[model samples]
Target: DTAVSQTPKYLVTQMGNDKSIKCEQNLGHDTMYWYKQDSKKFLKIMFSYNNKELIINETVPNRFSPKSPDKAHLNLHINSLELGDSAVYFCASSQDADSPLHFGNGTRLTVT
Candidate 1:
């Protein structure tokens, strides 16, 4: 079974549209995160939640928001999407800050 999973593996939308990506982890991990991979393949952490509490919020735009209703789930919502928003969003989880991460396949977002 997959340790981490994300919905809508591929998403295509027009600029200014609002979109969301849902993620869940079954690894019984305490920390979950959202990372974005840019066109250059550089990955950056967007947000991190530990036990349903927000722990890390990176320097991303205000238009991008992460919501965690529970410890096992982390969802990302983007408003007023722009062409620059086209990238792969990955959901990951780890037992702790020093543990290895288990990542989902990723959700590719395309804005035209």
Candidate 2:
């Protein structure tokens, strides 16, 4: 049932607002992660969780928060969105960090 799902494949909003993206996976994997890609398509890790436990936490801003509701769900919450926040947010997972990560199609976040 969980094949890494994220809502709003595309988001368009002006600067200075709050937005949250939802994600869920049914792979029964232990680890889930969030990656952010800039306009040029460079990906960077944002957060990761294993079996509902926080694992990898990247150097993201306080305005950005990632929450894992369980081993099967990881959601991203952003506050006071800025123009720089515009990028692709991808939800990924694997058995562990050493394993290859499988990513969703991606949510294109466009903050104006």
Candidate No. with top lDDT? 1
What is candidate 2's lDDT per residue for 1-112, written digit by digit as tens?
5488899799999889999998888877889999999978799999989988888889999999988878888999999999989999999989887888878889999988
Per-candidate total of colliding backbone pairs? 0, 1
Q: In model 2, how many backbone clashes occur?
A: 1
**Which prediction has the highest TM-score against the true structure?**
1
Scored by Cα lDDT, where does model 2 land? 0.89
Model 2 pairs whose backbones collide: 2-26
RMSD of each: 0.6, 1.2
What TM-score should be assigned to candidate 1?
Answer: 0.98
Provide the TM-score for each candidate, comma-separated: 0.98, 0.93
Q: Worst lDDT window (10 residues) for model 2?
A: 1-10
